[model samples]
Target: MERSQEYENTAWASPVCDAQEPRLAAAISGRRLPCFGRARPKKIAEGVGSLNVRSMTGRSREVADLMKRRKINILCVQDTRWRGNKAIDNWEMGTSSFFSRANKEGREGVGVVLNAEWKKHMVNVNRCSNRVMSIKLMYGKVTINIISAYAPQVGCSIEEKEDFWEQMDAQITWMGEEERIILGGDLNGHVGRNRNIIERTHGGWGVGERNEESENVVDFAVAFDMAILNTFYKKQENQMWTYCSAGRKSQIDLLMCRRNNLKEIKNFKVINGESVAPQHRLIVIDFEMKEERRGRQQQTSRIKWWMLKDQELKAEFKIKVLDRMVEAEDPDTWWTTSSRHIIEIGEEVCGKTSGKDPSPPRIRNLGVE
Candidate 1:
């Protein structure tokens, strides 16, 4: 189960469905349909993605850009191969907590990157080792613990893998019932397609045969009551495989969440294109949070009175106002109407505000006018 290099086979098979004729026609006519089992719009769904960048030294910014285009809120990074245990900020990419080798060349590093919106909620980061790292973020009323890890390959010693799982178990035990947990990264194991036997964790949509490593992954999930998220949704072969090598493909990199929160997961699939990492495709899952955000306060933009400072623009505004309000009955309504028309003319003559308008300040216990 060691991570393999790039493979040769990149061919994709057509989806098997009743409407294959139209889909095939569309394919032939150079039109592409959305991926199978892709979720439509959801009221509470939030996009989270994971990718093994192999090395995140110079490519972190590119990966962040890809996530932005895909609308990923939080992304788990693995195999960063960075040298330190400090946080790296790429400005546009937001902030990444890199936990890597403290001594020699960094390998098997893990990191977590949050979008600008989520970065403010980040509290503390725990760098357990080069193989494991965790970040805590407060989302409204609930706390979310996101653990990013890179598991040992099958060739590694059993003690190493066991110790890794033990660390993970300890991390999970640290969380309370109210706090949510998401453990994701390159586990380097296949959970297989036998959902009936492993009903507690596997979702029956996994490909390939089960092996000893797969058993290890399954045992870890079963012990912690977590579900392998990628297996829940049906997808094309290309969309299921997270790693490809030598015409061989496998679903090793995965995302797991508490079994109780499994219902919130709307879609999980391997995304194609945006190939920042050639070996691994991004895995994005959409899930709804328990808390809904409050409605935004209503407000109107202020008129651009600065435009009137220019003499030429002031003359233009005067001419437009005169033409629109020369003859008006009802003086009060005419003044109000004329003001709006004059403001429109001023805005057209010059530009409006440059930055985004924030919500108006809330007043505390103030009487209405």
Candidate 2:
């Protein structure tokens, strides 16, 4: 299931969808994500209603699982080295994405993705960093802007850090104050290892002064009044640290909204397996979506597949497939709660349904054991 990033397969994304991906075989070749976190935004759109955010830590298979979970809507990643021409279906039943991969074939790049059907409503503005993707969303005719960002390693000099801060300042200001904005990603900066009480502002960790680059991000967040939800980690000891590095841990990846109604972080394995080879864990964000597709509609694409016969028009049929799966027989046999758990990804849909009395599922045909 290993895919490549190149001039062709523009819609191609990460390699984390399949466990068979050669990249994750750490014992095989080069550093899995050596040039991962340095790319810039490649594609964009407006109205990204909901998303599943994560610092991929260079695993595409996990990215695919997150897509299938029906929990988070969009995903943000960092350090995705040499990612291009990767397959979306291989990751999830129905999923499509946009991404900026490592710049030098095995180095740095960045990208973003919206289910094709939802693309028309949103538009993306270009900036620096495969680390950042800005989406303009229209909620009930109300516009909301979101920026998915990732800062660089704190190894740069103070002068260089100042320059990055200036650029970050300009990009954020460009969003303007009129619209609602939610900015999330891995800042890679923390106040300190210990969650000490902050007298001034910010609840959780702040960026460290490893170098000037990180200091700039920390200072900017404080100046902008961006609330760090993970600050409340002390409130919920169970949820902390989106990634574990060198055996030490810290909450590097973040999810910050303009207005904080931060309910609860979904789970660690939202889009990944239970292994730790990639070095990072998955993070999911769940908030109210502005709008939901009410009925069946038509969509066209350039992708090809077993279901899509047309050479030009490609349609995501995952939703339709799951709907049928649920209605096949004693719905309760293969269902848990409700069919509302549908995840309409790129070209397909997959999800677990809930029934009144949920006790997992007991399916014989599909081998539910």
Q: Give candidate 2 regions above 4 Å deviation.
A: 1-62, 83-94, 192-201, 204-214, 233-238, 259-277, 289-369
Per-prediction TM-score, please?
Answer: 0.65, 0.50
Residue-level lDDT of model 2, residues 1-369, one tens digit each, is 236554456664556477556553223224444454454322223222222233345555555554445434555555555444222321333455554434435443344444544444565545464445566766455455656565665664667555545656766787756555666666666544333333233554333323333355456766765555545334333345455657766556665554332332222222234352344555554444333335644433321233233322233454354445544366775464334333233224222333333343443253222
In TM-score terms, which candidate is top?
1
Give all candidate RMSDs, comma-separated: 19.7, 25.5
Total backbone collisions for each predicted model = 1, 63
Give the per-residue lDDT of model 1 (tens digit) for 110-131. Answer: 8887777777788878888888
Scanning candidate 1 in windows of ten residues, the lowest lDDT window is: 22-31
